[model samples]
Target: MARPSTAHLGVDLDKAGKQVGFISIPHSPHEDAWGAVRIPICVIRNGSGPTVILQGGNHGDEYEGPIVLGELIRDLDPATISGRLVILPAINLPAVLAGRRTSPVDGLNLNRTFPGDPAGTITQQISAFVSDVIFPIGDMFVDLHSGGSSLNILPSAIIEPAPDPAHRRRNVEAVLAFGAPLTVVIDNLGEPRTSTACAVRAGLTTVGTEMAGAGTVSLDALKICRQGVRNVLAHAGVLLPAAAAPAAREPEAILKIPGQAGFVFATADGVFEPCHPLGTMVRSGQEAGRIHHLADPSRPPETLRYGADGMVYGHRQPGRVVLGNCCAVVASPYEGSLD
Candidate 1:
């Protein structure tokens, strides 16, 4: 049964046309009584076929997905597509506008609140609409992401293994089809409330990404992100003449993050100085970074070391670090050229 969501979609998904709409989020704040936060959404449908839901701006500071999606919404046409293309350039309107990772309004992390409560806060309502309304309609999903203000990461596509072997295999295939330089299968760190998890519960294949970060978008990141979208669409049968992409891209190198053993965290609060760059291989006991006590020059700097031999897949963006902050993340290599 489809519940009428508090978040309203402004367009008809069944109609064979292109339309721009908003997911109207009700907000009655002290400033205004009749105001609503409108999140951008677009639908392009030519005929009956698979539906692909593409979104970015889950975190306000991440630019790769939002940049690529905004361009897609403006340039994509209904006649060119065989099925339906749903685009949400900015999924979290409050956070996106505020340029923060979480919604400044309710201090909610949208990604962490999925299969949400319709009667909850603004972010929860949006999440509920996506899980209940959007997930039901779309056959495939891509929620793009980046490291945001706190981290810089190698361009990668991330997927969690489905419980079923066939579903797991197909999900891997989709990640390969996206053809990012690095493909990581997260073995742990389950985000049960994510849109991808919602899609999985509905038995749909999904692929999400972690592109360039540090809270800024680069031309190179956009180029790969746009191509990845095309590759996935062609792979999913939503776009015609798959040759529109390169005959073939170099196969992505598969990596795996095996639980908490895969990360290095800072124990002391200070300014962190990284010893390695993204994609660098590190040996166990090697110094990942050094935390300097800016306030106390006499105090010896604390050095963070790798506990396992692996590639440095992620790093904090800002040099400053705090106790318990993840300083670097490592991933075990699987196969293929990392070139």
Candidate 2:
């Protein structure tokens, strides 16, 4: 019923040793009639075990996932692992190359085009290739992401709400195994058109991350991303425990974003001034920030207040904001049990 993808893979996924290749997606522009966008992928296999799919660069500006996954593709010895590792460091090659959130080829957000259309735009075609060609063979999916150029998010690992309790529990376990300083149990964040959603719907254990973001990469976030990938591999049995040095077991805070009220948004276009930094504890109705009206200096600055009580999970990065732009998001500690 679905059209076949116009993408070609140069690497054999079932191959024994580590093989590096590209997923060539056909393209035709005014400058060239027959051109292709080559997305780099690496396949590492040793023996029989669960296959783990690791990916990054869903957004052009987020650099942590691509950096850590790139290093893994180069340094990870296939012989030390029991299963396969299908790594796509820069899944959205066009966006990564352009350093923009959406692809320059089609001006579409790859994240929102899940289980995509082969007959659609370049972004949709890429999504279709990943959904059709990739998701079917994966046992677990790990997508790394940062806030990109928009927000500064606290370092956290996120697990989506699954179809069943058992599946949800598996995702929760994966988040724990990921061992990020902040673990978030999300209920889709009102956006279902994501790679994580695609993987989860296909019954794969999915774990995603929100490493620090703000256009520039953070060293602290990089450390978490690097170690988190290894932790997930070790947890999935794809990598031996000895091969991946685990982080010191510590009691990490598990949080959940309360729907709607947890977010603070700009009501009008203006320059924003935050009252608190991320990780700060605040109460509902508290002054979160203020937006100064530049067009009319006489108008008093609008004071934005929190709608929910929790830790400041994320906030807008740039000083300028437009109407409906998210200014801050609060997350409360999750007391519910996944078990």
Q: Which candidate achieves the best lDDT against the true structure?
A: 2
Candidate 1 root-mean-square deviation in Å: 2.7
Off by over 4 Å in 2: 1-3, 245-252, 335-337
Which has the greatest TM-score?
Answer: 2
TM-score of each model, paired residue for residue: 0.95, 0.96
The alpha-carbon deviation from the true structure for residue 246 of candidate 1, after best TM-score superposition, in angstroms, is 4.0
lDDT of each: 0.84, 0.90
Tens digits of per-residue lDDT for model 1, 251-301: 345788757878889989999999998888889898988999999999999
Q: Residues 1-339, candidate 2, lDDT per residue (tens digit)?
A: 335777899999888999999999889989879999999999999999999999999999899999999999999888889899999999999999999899999999999999889888888988898888888899999999999999999999997878688998889888788878898877756687999998999899999999999989899999988888998899999988875555553334678898888999998899999999899999999999999999999999999999998999999999999999999999987777665
